[model samples]
Target: MSFTLAIVGRPNVGKSTLFNRLVGKRLALVDDQPGVTRDLREGEARLGDLRFTVIDTAGLEEATDDSLPGRMRRLTERAVDMADICLFLIDARVGVTPSDEVFADILRKRAAHVILAANKAEGAAADAGVLEAYGLGLGEPIRLSAEHGEGLNDLYAQLAPLADEFEARAARDAPETDVEVGEDGDEGALPAFSDKRPLQVAVVGRPNAGKSTLINRILGEDRLLTGPEAGITRDAISIRTAWDGVPMRIFDTAGMRKRAKVQDKVEKLSVADGLRAVKFAEVVVVLLDAAIPFESQDLRIADLAEREGRAVVVAVNKWDVEEHKQEKLRALREAFERLLPQLRGAPLVTVSAKTGRGLDRLHAAILRAHEVWNRRVPTAALNRWLAGMLEQHPPPAPQGRRIKLRYMTQVKTRPPAFVVMCSHPDKMPDSYVRYLVNGLREDFDMPGTPIRLTLRGQGDKNPWKGRRKSQPSALRKHLKKGT
Candidate 1:
């Protein structure tokens, strides 16, 4: 029942800029290039005391069928349809164009409520464009510069009423079902520690990857012994800390090594323990040494997180020592892009865990990725995206028979697992599955979280079916016949 506010506009109109402004962090990639944002990105937005889900959609463009621009437009349209309120952003510096008019028409036909925002409206230069925005017919536009943080009070005032209305509607429509907490006596003396209560986040990586240092910084003390030794920490330790007033129980596990070279019993036990920690953790922060980033072991660990269905955040530690930091960062990003395509947009943060630099950003990224992990896209909107995906690139046929993926539903979250019922589950190729996972990751803005897709054959029959009629006599007769 969360309210969603979608920011929509043509390319280079500062939709991502406004998204970063509302989300209060520069999570979305910003570049001078047009259409840098190919996917729909979402974040939990806060405007003063007003809290809502804000979605940054792909730039709207007019294109012919089967083009990238057309697919991007379809993605934007889907986001607009799912939103309760739409914030239509226009570049006040450049004024409205034909693309803006087309999108405004689309919004007029689809969106229930719309708010016009004139971005880059700083000084007197933007006045004319702000006035020109009225041509869209949405209403008077609120002028602001996302980069400079100008005119936010007006934006807050505009959103407050919509937020209040959404809250009221949600309260009215809320279901009566409530989860009952069992008492200690009734539950046969509940354990003093409930492992499921506080969110468990695991910090894992290779040896000397700053796992121990990061934990020490987070706890603000020498809780775990940190040394120059390769395997200084031998056991997984759990510490309870409140991050930004949110209670979180973090698990710091020993560094993992390659299985073939695990010589000692202690190292084997530690590796097994680390794997178990990954399984238990709701979110896993994979720490990587900036000196040797994205090694084979790193990829293996990330793949393990994906296989285990855990939210992942890749942290590059000791970034301060690197000579060409930006260059190294770009190379690392490219490597991640090429190597781990499954986690297409996984959150990557560069931090100096030694000096406590970028800790705040790392924490924020972990929290944001966790939010995406727990996110659930509505059934209607998911189906809409699925239909668009199919139209864009139809799945390939196997043995002259088309593989029809009929329906998709989110069966579980906390690493968002989905079930896509199809005609032939076995015939579906791995490449096609990767295509769908990438599409879901991009369209749903579920970055940094492992998305699980399970294919179930439509023709598979349940064993429980028709079992009610066959009693003990039928089973005995079948046994006798077999004998």
Candidate 2:
């Protein structure tokens, strides 16, 4: 694990703002309203030359019971305990309040390394407040303006020694590098397991479609809060787990409703958070309620996933209550075919998030989708397929000359992208491109994964490609003399 820094403060003190600045992105939901952040968000933070893990925690409240604020407090406390250091922030504009005093005392007892920071200390208005922060007895406060990217150098100065210590410890603890040898004592290629990276999968859908239920069931525990209530999940909480022995990280996002219906500021943040999860995930499961599958919003969500180029898996939740199983299944197939033509052969697995039925099938489908998303085809095979395709239905030429496709090769994978060297590529019709893409999908067994096909015409060096070469004047005169 890397050095972890947990930012702790009361609500609206710019903890998230500081987090966004450090991470170089607006990952956490930032609002002027207090208590906007209700969960712990973690990001890889980079400040100057220091790189470490930074946690954005929910604001601390005075509550100590099991209420919502209380729960958020516990989560924040967990983050504090898990961190290597705690950044206790006080709002310089608001000055030190009783809540800041309370949290400061708590951090004094809980954290080994506590750094006090007075945020929003950009102008003379906060001078008195910045001086007042000294009464907390945690040492000189680092005056900061997180929104304006001020005071980071001082922050980095505080963190440099810690980062150096962590790097030294990590280097000391790292295992010696060694090469694997075959049974015959010859060096061998590294095993496939060496390439393992945590797979990110996000479960998304409309409100109350069992998104949380499905994720909890897959995890085999009630790690995430869930109930019959719609919109219970407000943050995109990502849980790390192993699915059937394969390491994976699953994100349970807030259910996204239509744009007009999302009026609450908090809900808007939640929706944006969910969209970010989808964009970050490697595979997106658009869980739909079987009773009301393929709603306009459902189609929109699936389309969004597809357009993002993430591998998609359509899952029908609440299958146990579904009546007329065979009829419903057939109808689902037909509806999927009719509605989502772009994701033509994407996996549509039926599962009951409540009863956990069909979970194994869903797991297999997810793994398969991930595999197809990362699939690669060899250059030889690609050119061969291109040849067969051109022979079957050659590109249509608008003028007299026929368009020539000279070379084709896979440019990259992870949603296989190809580039075809050709003549008159600009004139190639969209219909022909679609034809080639469909052929690639069908022949490559890469159903539902996005395919990128780029057509490139002859380069400038080959400017006279389609023109006939005229005989030289000297050759023409010699031929006339011979006649």
Candidate 3:
């Protein structure tokens, strides 16, 4: 089982900042405004060699039982209940307030284990508050500045013991399970990750589409070589980055071209490398040139992602020089619907990779699309939807015999795949299958991620019955002897 940790604190106490620090990404929005985080965001968190799930919760605030703040508090309480440990953060610069004391009391009552953190403890300003945190009775607080990345080693030391204890308990409970070691070493080794880890995002497009330029701008450095030259990047190179404190691993792929034009051996190699990057990526951002958007190659790349069952987001790059922005966006939407019908509702964000205009929106759109792609529709809701669909348009009869699609169940997620057990699998037409897939995408709000519908034929006989053996030989011999 995955270990869970919750980051809890009052508003502007640097909970989001500490969350970003632990997760190593700015996934949670950080603003000076109080109560900015109204939702609980959970991600895999890593501290040194320790890995666990971490939930970033909304700030504790004053509200009635039915109010929004109260609802947020309930969410935080739920996180506390689910967590193996809680990291209670306080702003050392501001010192403890009545709200802090109230929340501390709540945490004492709710959380199973608590680790106190004195955030923003950079200068002498925070010394008094750090000393005052001892009054909370949560144990010694680890003083650190989340923004400047100070005192992390001390934080790790505090967490390592807890992690080791959890791991030891888990191992003791599962002694019979085989722990196979892989070529890399211990197969059972704890996964190296945390929610603050960078998201693995790949930028793919045809040659000379400014993929390199976009990556450089995002990094705010000349990390990847860029020029007016086409096919400069011959191999996929990944760069580790933090966007607004959101850890992101970006793969800049070589520009892909048609198979026929990729005659050169180096270009062919580059294409293969790019393809591999796309396969490995969790989310693919297809960058298109604003001047020549939605070409045959672009459609093919998008189709490749759908076929491979990867999440996709389209970015129309170099929009700074585009003459008719609105018209182009409209036409692009139509073309996406017409050409790449499978990814009909996938997000399309227009950006000038040159000027860095609309990059934020682009990032936001990619994150949202990824969330939808990874979404799981509950089995109950799915079956209800399926029943409604079958009621509206019953399966077509083949040879005047009605094909019974008996039951449907989701077999897998992450590009949700469903298996529909039916009377005749071979008789199901392609049109009807497409109808179901389309309906699933539209009704369930799953766009961009490929939906797989499979039909399993259930034959007319009960398979569990034992085979019958002939017993007439002995009786026939006995009758002959009597005669």
Candidate 4:
């Protein structure tokens, strides 16, 4: 296992910012509001030549067992236990508070290696607090500015030795293995990574859509906080596990309500965070209540996922409670086909998040959708299909000149994108593009996934094709001669 480092501190001390800097991506959302990060997020971190797994944890707090802050504290404690070292942060401008002291005591008792950091300590106003951090009893404080990229070298100096020691110990304990060589006898060549990346699925829908309940049913545990409350989930929490041997990462996002109704600042942040999760996900499962299926908001959510170029699976929740199963299923399918024709062939599975009914079907549908999304077609077959499409319903000619399509090729996949070399790209109507896209979907068994068909014309910019160019304007030629 790689060396692990966990960042733990009270709320709004720039812990998330430091996490982003180390991971070189903004995976964790950061804001001025306290308690913004409510879950632990892990990523590979790099500083100079050092590489380790860095986990960004929710800010620690002292609260009773049942409250939200208390739950977050418990989760952060789990992260501390999982790490090889802990970096406890304190805001230099504010100095140490009672909460910081309480957390320090806990980390001292629990963590094997503790590194203290005084953040936001760049200016003269923070001088006193920087000195105050020395009394935390962890060690000498590393005066760091996570946002401005300062004091990382000092922090690296402390981490380098620990990383080296960990590597040495691990190497000594590793089992002996034989190295395989290719026919060319390449020396010391490491084996290629054969394991595929886990498929990332994001579950999203309107408020109280049973998204969390469905995830719990799949995981067979109450890994998420689910209640009758509408907005209990505030952050996009990702859980990694295997579903029947298929490695997967599932994201449970906060329910998204319409913009006009979102008045609270926290809810607004929650919704934006959910949208980011959708963008990052490979397949998005739009869960809906069976009784109120195809609501305007539900349709909008599914449409957003489609537009984002993600594989979509429509899952109807609370199916166990429905009285008329056959009628409800038929009606839901018809409404889905009529309302979201763009995703015609996408999988629609019904499940009861509360009872776990139809979960096997849901799992199969997700795997199938993922497969179609990653499918590719050869260039020769694509051109042959294009010819058949043109023969059946030829493109329109706006000014008595028929548009000629010469070639077609699949440029990329993951919601397959294609480019067709045509006579006039700009003149191709939206209806025609839709016709081609639908044809691709029907002909290639690529239903329900987003398909992109772009028209490109040959580089000949001359407007007058197959016509003799008018002799260079006689007046222009005479003017050039005179000049």
Candidate 5:
């Protein structure tokens, strides 16, 4: 029932600013620099009482060839075709440039419904520019200031009627359903199938690792702009789809470089955004280049996912071009074990993001990793396993005092965490904790998933806890003696 509104303009015309204002969040990255947004980002927008879907697109460029800017232009044109309305924003401060006129012509032909907005029209300085915007012949330009939050009521007024029309069309096309509502407005007989929330997966790696290309293969469409350019994607773009019959919301994040090498402000923001995506993701696919597998940055990315307690699956991309596949895969497995001992048994899949080979195996690996990450062991089994491990290799006694582990229990899953009630929890060494963690992984078939082991020192119960102690007074003793 909702309509899609795409904001198209030349670079730095306040398109992303207006998008952030409408979405009520900084979903799209904004900067004074042009072309900061390279991919289309979608968000649910709310203005006044009207609601619709808003798309923040890359700046419309004049290039029509296979260059990066040309690819960006093609992607924006696709958005124009998909959107129900196109809100053309022009900089009131810079007035209408030649590029703006060109893009206006394109939108006039491509966009079904077009609304002209002269953004940053805050004061008298923007009045002449606003007047110039009318020469494009789209319509009367709405004088707007996205940064200052002015003229939004006019934007709302312009969109409300279009929203109504879309809703009317949706109602007319909607299929009829005969259903009964029970008390509290609940449906009495719902469908047998229940909707499950899609799994959240994020693909992250160093620059030019084919992260976007892999996701495009999964999506079966050119949903994101991809090229030989190292860092085309600037934001963590998430798309929802069904892959291998499993519903998933997959995030294609910007490539992360080392801290010392990153000097640009926009790249810094991009790296931070990718890190945030990893945190929100339940499963992280660490994509690596087949030609240069297990670089320092790749290891860092995988370790980061592990340290964040996310399910990790290592994938070597661009495998189709490899000549000695078996030798490379063997060396890859060896290096994975030697470098990332923490992620020892994790699934390492060889995939070709370009040719789309080995995707089925990658999907199976991801599901397996997720299952292992969420695997939980019962308390009885855990305690029994702990007893056996302790008997086999007892806890070290520091300074001739023996350490005692009384009980063990799994406190939580999702990178399954456990607690051990013991004596001298602080005295327990990291080596011992690793021992127990490795033991749990092996005994419980929880391979490659990060495990958290916590030791709590158990003390003797204090019977006098929470009770006030009364002392016998000397005066009371003397009175008793006199009596």
Candidate 6:
């Protein structure tokens, strides 16, 4: 039996610290600054013998307008509604503030089960604040030091009974197992996850390119924080959801800027985290602002994806606002070919992340790109193609001798790496290698995906090259002479 717990509180109340403690990871970015987190980050948490889902929400704020803080507050309220339990946190050193009391009133009316916690309670100075928490009318506050790992036992004691109760209610509500639908319009099988493993796709671009907005539209909910803020996302938050029945784990990364411009320490960490996500991802979507498409930083990011051997997809966002679509798209294509020749022939999808338009096409392009990335070629087909290519445009014969490509075979996939057994491998020119790579891409339908082609000599090491006859040969000669 499983249940979800949401950690909620005002800014810098140690909610993220406790979340990390519960999930046993520093998944959420934490800093001394207030309101570092602005999204609903969920993880599987284990406390003692109990295991369940936990959500780390943005700090409760007093904003009610359509500002960033207000949006963050709305997102947190959604988490409280979705979670089975809410761990309301307070700063024991500072006691409860007006914002805390206001949110407490809200959570009392909304949350099904609330557990008040007085965090940062390790020293005696926090005792008065902990005592002052009793006036909030939620319940007795548990003294906790999330950084030092204190008060977890008390937290566990509070959660065990609730866990058992949830398990009981789930058992009661569970449908019967011996039922099946005939051919009529009756009930169907229970919902289950797709049999395929979730495809990992990372969305990366410069700031304010609508990466998080696109993800939220696909999720059909406001799962990520978004506003006019360019860098609302501070961490590479990965959300697993099925898009049109295909399971996927999508990462919403922080907007990347030029290295020289990124001076803030926390932004540096956030960018680093996003870069890590790009490396872990199989397909990377390089989003572009339609108005300012293909800037230097955008090209750098796409080139980074190609160099990392990730399948690349270029998505031009904000198409709804573009005035001359045809002209702009043609210019974008020409620029893409002129600048990013490595990712030539990749699918360039035009989407409006705000209106949720062209998402179906985007989905198809991603799946197709992934398919091309993981494509494998048979040795026979590769050798046949190699023979044709060699015949049409032979290798450059440097000096007097010709470089012979004796054999070719695919060594691996996931970016489709290949090795060619050839004589004078070290003498092959870069231009010739590029020719062969271009031929492979054109002939094998592997356009836009990174292709690794290696040249190797067949005789780098021979067993009998420098060795004399064994002692057994001398022994045989001596025996014959004696005979």
Q: How does each model score on TM-score?
A: 0.55, 0.76, 0.58, 0.80, 0.93, 0.93
Q: On residues 1-483, what C-alpha lDDT tens digit does candidate 6 reach at each position?
A: 989999999889888898899999988888888888888888889999999999999989889889998899999999999999999999999988887889899999999999999999999999998998998899989999999999999999999999999999999999988877667663566343353568899999999999999999999988899988899998899999989988899999999999999999889989998999999999999999998999999999999999999999999999999998999989989999999999988999999999999899999999999999999999999899999989999998889899999999998998999999999999999999999999988988988999999999998567787888767678799999999
Ranking by lDDT: 6, 5, 4, 2, 1, 3
Q: Write the per-residue lDDT of candidate 4 for residues 1-483, one digit (tens) a residue.
A: 369999999999999999999999877778888887876778889999999999888888898486777777887888999899999999999999998999999999999999999999999999999999988898899999999999999999999999998999999999999998668875666432113568899999998999988888888876676667677777787888787667888999989998899998878888988999999999999999998999999999999999999999999999989999999889998999999999998999999999888999999999889889998999999999989999999999989989999999999998899999988889889999999998889999998999988889887866788898678888999999999
Kindly provide the TM-score of model 5 when superposed on the true structure, using C-alpha atoms.
0.93
Q: Which stretches of candidate 1 lie over 4 Å from their true place?
A: 1-196, 460-483
Instruction: For candidate 1, report its TM-score.
Output: 0.55
Report the Cα lDDT for candidate 1. 0.83
- Angstrom error at residue 90, model 2: 1.5
lDDT of 2 by residue, 1-483 (tens): 369999999999999999999999877778888887766778889987777889888899899887767767887888899899999999998899998999999999999899999999999999999999999999999999999999999999998988788889899999999987666763565332221467889999999999878988988965565666788788888877888877788898999999999999989989988999998999999999998999999999999998889999999999999879999999999999999988989999999989999999999999899999999999899889999999999899788878889889888887789999998888899999999999989998999988889999876676787899986799889999999
The alpha-carbon lDDT assigned to residue 473 of candidate 4 equals 89
Candidate 2 stretches with Cα past 4 Å from truth are: 48-50, 63-67, 137-140, 153-196, 210-242, 249-252, 264-280, 318-331, 351-359, 376-412, 417-444, 451-483
Would you list the clashing residue pairs of candidate 1? Answer: none
Residue-level lDDT of model 1, residues 409-456, one tens digit each, is 998888788998889899889989989988998888988688888999
Output the better candidate (1/3) by TM-score: 3
Best by lDDT: 6
Model 4 regions lying over 4 Å from their true place: 179-196, 210-228, 232-241, 249-252, 263-270, 320-323, 352-357, 378-411, 418-436, 455-483
* Model 6 pairs whose backbones collide: none
The per-model lDDT (C-alpha) reads 0.83, 0.89, 0.83, 0.90, 0.92, 0.92
Where does candidate 5 have its weakest 10-residue lDDT segment? 186-195
Give the root-mean-square deviation of each candidate in angstroms.
26.4, 5.1, 19.5, 6.1, 3.6, 3.6
User: How big is the positional error of residue 8 in model 4, measured in Å on the Cα after superposition?
Assistant: 1.5
Better of 2 and 3 by lDDT: 2
